[model samples]
Target chain A: MIHANDEPAVPMGLPLPNGKLAMWLFLVTEIMFFTALIGSYLIYRNGQPTASQPWPTPHDVHLAEWIGAVNTFVLICSSLTVVLALWSLHVGNSKRAVQYIGVTLALGCVFLVIKAYEYQQKFAHGILPGRVFEKLDSPHGYKYMRHVQEQLEHIEKHGGVNDKAKKACAELLADIRAGKLQPKDVNERVRGTKSIKETNPGKEFITTKDSTYVDLPERSRPKDAPMVEGILEMDTHAHLSYSIPFGNMWASCYFAMTGFHALHVFGGLVVFAIMLVMAWRGRFGPQNAQMVEVTGLYWHFVDIVWIFLFPLLYLV
Target chain B: MSEQHHDHSHGDHSHSHGDHSHGEHSHSHGGDAHGHADDAAAHFRSYIAIFIALCVFTAISFVFNELVRGGIISPMTSATVIMIVAIIKAGCVAYIFMHLKADWGKVYCIMIPVVIMCVMMIIVFLPDGVLGWR
Candidate 1:
C-alpha cells in the first residue's frame, strides 16, 4: 500500500513546526528589546546620586526577590506539567494528556494573578514608574523642621533684612501661599550643601494623586495650613525631580519586552486549550500526537524566557 | 534501496527472510518491555538532574546578587559571575533535558539562530552603553 511520490509523508515525531519556529523568532526579537531596556536601566542606575556616593548603604529591597522567587516556582511547576503532558501523549494516554494540560493552564493563571497582586503592592507603596514621587517623611524631617523654626526666628529678629534673608523669607511666604514648601528647600539654601548630610538614610517617599500632600495622611490637615508641631517634614514633593532623563526610555523597553513575552505565554495557553479540546474528543492517537509535542516546545520556550527575565529584572 | 521489513514477533507473522536485510532489530519480549520501562525512568531522572542543576545555579545567582547589593562586590563582578552561571545552566538544560547530546548537529541548527540573536542584542546594546558613559 505505497503512496504516490507527490504525497507528503507524515513524520513520526514532531520535528519542529513552522509556528514553533516563528514563535522562537519572535522571542529572539524580545531578547533584543529587553537588552536595550535593562542596559538602559544599568546606565541610569550608575548615574543615580547613590551610585557615586560610595554605593549607597544597601537597604532591604527584598520584596522583589520574594515575589520573583514565587513567580519562578510557579513557572517551574508549570514546566513540569507541560513535560508530563507531552509524555502522556507519547504513551498513548490522551486523557492524562488533557489532565496535565489543564493543570498547566491553571498554574499559568495562578502566576499571572500573583504578578498582578505584586504590581498592586508596588502601587500602594507609591513606587510606581512615573514622574510624581512624594518624598516620604524621614528623620531629615527634623532638620527641615529646625530650618523652618530658625527662619521664623530670623524673620522675627532682624525683620529679615539681609538679601539672602529676604530671599529666604520671600520663598517661605511663597511656599505658605502655594502650600508646597519643604524643609530641605530652606536648609540646603540657608545652611549650604555641605552642612546637610549627603545621604538621608531614612528618606521615604509616597506617591498618591497629584493633589495629595506628602504629609496629608500623617498630618490629617490641609496642606496650606501651617502645622503647630514645629517639626513637620517640609513638602518638597513638588520640587523633587523624579525625572531621570533616560529612565522612561529604559522603562518603556522593560515593559515592552516583558509584555511581549507574556503575550506569547498567553498564546501558548490558547493553543494548548485548543489541543486539549481535541484530545478530549479522542482525535489525537499515538499515530498522530504531533500537536502535543509542538505545544510542549512552545511552553518550554516561554519558561526559558522567564528564567532569563527573573534575574534581569529583579536580581540585577 | 529495496523495501525491506522485519517481523519482530518471532514465528508469529508469516514473512519472507529477505525482509531481515533492512536492519530492523528485534528483542526478546521481557527484555524489550523492561528496556522501555527503564528508558522512561531514565528520562524522568534526567528531569530531576536538570532541576537540581537549575536550583544550584539559581542559588549562586542569589549569593552573587546579595554580595553586589550589599556593596561587597562590584556590579561588573556580579554581572560576570551571573553570565557564566547562566550560560552553564542554559547549556545543561539544552543539551541534557532537551536531548541535544543525542543529535549534536540537529541541536546546532537551533543553537546557531540563538547565538546570532544574542550577538545582535550585544551589538545593539553596545552603543547605548558606550554613549551613556560619555
Candidate 2:
C-alpha cells in the first residue's frame, strides 16, 4: 500500500469530507423506507380501488386528511428552522443557530403529537378495513327492508301496495304454514322471486309460486318482516356486484409507508435535539456547524417524504 | 480540525483557534468573538423569513389535503399535486436552510448517493405492491 502522503488521493466535489457522504447514504435508506410503502399502495389499490360500497362514497378518509395536512405544515416549518439554524452558523452566530435548531426539534415533536391524535381517531371509528370486510356481504339481511321502503314510497305516490300483490303474498305464506297446498304443489308459485335464506336439511319444504321464497333458518329471519307481497323495486339499486374484500394490499401498504416515514421524522427530531444541546454548548460555532447543517438536511428530507405521503394516503 | 479534536470544557473561555486552515474551513465567530453585530443581527431576519415561508406552505398543504381527503377530490390526483408542492418546499429548505447552495461542490457527491438510495428504496418496496407484502 502506498503511504498516506504518497497516495494520489484527491478531494471529492469541493471536499468537506465524509460527513456529507454519510448523510446521503442515510437519505438513500429513507427513500427505500418510503418506497416500500408507496409500492405496496400501488399494488393494493390496483386490486381494489372501488371496494367501498355505494360506488365511491367518501368515507372517513377525510378525517385523516385534516391531521395529515397539519402535520405536513409542522414538518415544513421545522425544515425551515433547520435551514435558518444552518444559516446562523454560516454568517457566525452559534447561539442563534442553536436556538433555531431547538425550535426545529420542538416542531417535529408537535407534528408527532398531532399524528397520534389522528391515529386515535382512526381506532375509534371502527374504520379498520379488515373489520369492515366482515359486514360487506348482502347488506346484513336488510335488503328486503330497503326494498319494502322503496315500494311503500311508490305506493304512497300512486295509491298503495297493489291489492293483487298483497293477496298473492299472504296466500303464499298461508299455504306454506298450512301445508294445505304444497308450495311446490303449485307450479305457478315458484316463478319470479330470488331466494335469500338457505333451505334447512331436515325442514319440510313449502313450495311457493315464487322460487325465491325459500324459508330462512328461524334465527336468521328478521323480527319485523315487511309484508312480502309485491316486488317493490327501488329507483336506486344496490350494486352488490362488486363488494371487494377489505384489509387487502392497499390498507397494508398505507399503514407501512406512513408508519415508517413517521418513525424517520421521529429519528430526525432526536438528532435535532442533540444538535441543539451541542449548539448551546458553543460546540457548533462557525467551524463545526456542519453537524447542524447535516442534521437539517435530514429534517428537510423527512418533510419532503411526508409531503408525498400525505396526498397519496389521504387524497387517494 | 483542531476545534473538532479538542474537548474544551464549558469553562474554556479563550476561543480555541488552531488547525482551522487544514480543511475547507469555516470560522466560528462566537457571540463574543464577532465584531460585526449588524451582520449577525441580519441573519436573524433571514431566519424569520424561512419560518414564515414554512408556515404558509404547511397551511396550504393542510387545507388542500383536507379537501382531498374529504373526498371532495380523489386521493390519487391530490397526492400527485401535493407531491409537487412538497418537492418545492423541500428544495427551499435544502438549498437555503441546509446551505447546500453555499457549501463545497464536492458535497454533492454525498447528496447524489442519498438520492440514489431513495430510488432504491422505492424499487425495493414496489414488490410489496404487487404481492400484498406488508
TM per candidate: 0.60, 0.57
**Model 2 clashes, total count:** 20
Write down the TM-score for model 1. Answer: 0.60
Scored against the native two-chain complex, candidate 2 gets a DockQ of: 0.20
Instruction: Give the Cα error of residue A180 in candidate 1, in Å.
Output: 7.3
DockQ of each: 0.12, 0.20
| Residues B1-134 of candidate 1: C-alpha lDDT, one tens digit per residue | 01011112211121332223111333459866566455546666666777777777877887887776555777668878876776676676555544444434333565577678766766666665545444
lDDT of 2 at A78: 75
Compose the digit string of candidate 2's lDDT tens values, residues B29-120: 67433433444455456556766776676666666656653446554455566667667766766655554544424356555766676667
Evaluate residue B38 in candidate 1 and report its C-alpha lDDT on the 0 to 100 scale. Answer: 58
In order, the Cα lDDT scores of the candidates are 0.52, 0.51
* RMSD, candidate 2, Å: 14.5
Q: Which candidate comes out best when scored by DockQ? A: 2
